[model samples]
Target: MKTLNTRLDNAIKKLYTAFHNNTLHPECCKQCAVGNILDNSDSWKHFSDEHGSTKLNYVGRVNEAFGKRFNGYTPSELLQIEVTFLKACGYQLPIHYKNTKPDTPTDKDVLFNGLQAVIEFLCKLDNNLNVMDYTKIFDKIKCDFIEKSPVK
Candidate 1:
């Protein structure tokens, strides 16, 4: 069994490459968050007819019933991650062309936002801390331990 940390690391690396290569796209099954996590496979699209729908389709339901986990994420988790990514990137749910989207879908900022959201969700899935969260670094406090030369 692959650990969730390993899966999360691999997903983050794949997403980083896709984002830097300008290949990540909300409309592209093979370049979206779930696709990248699944090694750029579009098979995840079979989970649902709508891009951001959390409701699993027949295929997805069967997969879930079989305890299918792609890259350590369940069928429903995949949908939620994609929806979170799309929403963070400023796209409306279901990803209709008529729906709202970032002014430039390929913009670094937009993709970064999407990636960040996905990473956070992935961490949440495993009950792990968000690796991208730097706030904890700032929370670190230095404590000085005093040595006692003698005890009375």
Candidate 2:
């Protein structure tokens, strides 16, 4: 029999792929919960460096309001959440090109690995996860953002 962790991991992978393929929503990223957090945080540089100061400031304010919910998660766990959230929201992980040496993995490769780590962590967090469990987590994340997000 498969372990609960294995089941959850499989479910999250399926959901992540569905989200990535736009089977859920085509424009989900524009209003994504985790995307909003990353777009507003200093860590956004890890994904994209093109944001202007004003946009970054806006992201900062958003983070100020919602960052506390993620206080205990490790950086890697946070990255997983961000990647999962982005995929579920119908967005693509940005392809960073900083370490493309022959032996090193590309940005896409790193992101894929990150996603796998996230699945493992999430699966371990709950032993009785269903496919909708991640969606519930996503909803909570979204609710936190919507509740604390500043006015446009």
Best candidate, lDDT: 1
lDDT of each: 0.85, 0.41
lDDT of 1 by residue, 2-47 (tens): 2357877788888878988888987788889888888889998998
Give the clash count for each candidate: 0, 1
What CA RMSD would candidate 1 show? 4.9
RMSD (CA, Å), candidate 2 to true, equals: 17.5
TM-score of 1: 0.85
Model 2 CA deviation exceeding 4 Å by range: 1-70, 95-128, 131-152
Tell me which residue pairs clash in candidate 2.
40-59
Model 1 stretches with alpha carbons more than 4 Å out: 1-4, 141-152
The CA lDDT at 64 in model 1 is 98
Q: What lDDT tens digits, residue by residue, belong to model 2 across residues 9-38?
A: 444544365446433221233322233323
